[model samples]
Target: MLAHHTLTGPEDAPVLVLGNALGTTTDLWSDFSLPFRLLRFDHRGHGLSPAIDGPCTIADLAGDVVELLDHLELRQVYYCGVSLGGMVGMWLAAHTDRISRLALVCTTAWVPDKGRLDERIAQLRSSGMESVADTIMSRWFTPLCPPDAVARFRAELLNVDLPTYLACVEAVREMDLRADLVKIDVPTVVIAAAQDHATPTELVRQTADELPDSELYVVGDAAHLAVVEAPRTISVILDDHFGNDLT
Candidate 1:
């Protein structure tokens, strides 16, 4: 099971589950605030979670989330994910009734850069996480990113298990969920980072357009890690989307 942290709320509060991006952990949402029971966890092979030795699919990762929720005895939750997390959220929201509402932040409907992902895989296999730290950080944040946040994310990257990290990279490399977007029936919010090079604005826009019941919000001046880079804006958007009495 994934390592999870729960924020206790009122007895009858709807659960809000937070999923981290590719290389980060639950700390990715350390600054987020909302009035619900918040559940945050490390994706498989990330943070304190058990590692996998080889490649896996986005559905494989999403299955881990299902197991996590079941293990926690949670019947339903409002879900949010960033980048890779968002991909998994899309899968869950489409394939199951567990996710009551979803907020996909800086995520895409498919892997648009297989060639780039191949290059990243080669670099990671050769020199480990440090090899692409600068490039990833550059795409992950805008110039407004603070040194401390960058440093913390850098540390998170460095701690990743190499095989497990590569497995997730492979998942991103193989992901193509465009055909599946139409199946998502729940209320969804697709958030884009204006400066995001990783997912790109157009890709996120298309994700919003494909979902039958989705709202689009773009945050200016942030990049791939919009939730971390523009916490207040992201938090407010999430509140407006998932904070209603939909539960």
Candidate 2:
């Protein structure tokens, strides 16, 4: 349980925890270059972290973060998460005071299509990750995305631990954070991909609308993995949101 993490940037800088999406490890944030201390980690069983045998909730995943912060002696930090990672960010901001600022990228407060998600989970369980890897990769990026980037992400998806991925998928399937948005009092930014079919722009908008204090930003020509497809745009948005208060 500590969740394998790499903390970089200035030692004395404000801590900014980066959460990874489902099927992704800390490498998902490899492109980021910001001022604050960046803490990136792999979810349980995803990378070097140990996986649990049974199912878990988003709060359970978020608790891993709390435990990681405690181990590092970090009291409060800016948090940014993509997809499943964003789900964790929402939970942390709503339930704990550890998060000072929040950025949710290409994520929703709840799964809008439970039937579809259930079907996907069933497919993965019955057929394996290979059977659904192409479909998942297709949704991660638009056709305009570079082939190299697509290949890289596809490989990352393939390398994920099947059991843990399913566990996280179950977490998403059972998750319902619509009511908790109001409790997240920190300055929050909800980033969406205009062409993202996984977590559409409207859903992201709804999440921002529910949050008591939040703003919405949509990145064009990108799909679910907008952070990878448009690293510069994502960087600028994050820097503007988190860099303003370095004190």
For 78-185, candidate 2 gives per-residue lDDT tens digits of 999999999999999999999999999999999879998899899999999999989998899899988998888888888888988999999999999999998999
Write down the worst ten-residue block by lDDT for model 2.
238-247
Per-residue alpha-carbon lDDT of model 1 for 113-143, expressed as tens digits?
6999999999998888898998999989888
Which parts of model 2 have CA positions greater than 4 angstroms off?
none
Q: What TM-score does each of the candidates earn?
A: 0.96, 0.98
Question: In candidate 2, how many Å is residue 59 off?
Answer: 0.6
lDDT of each: 0.88, 0.92
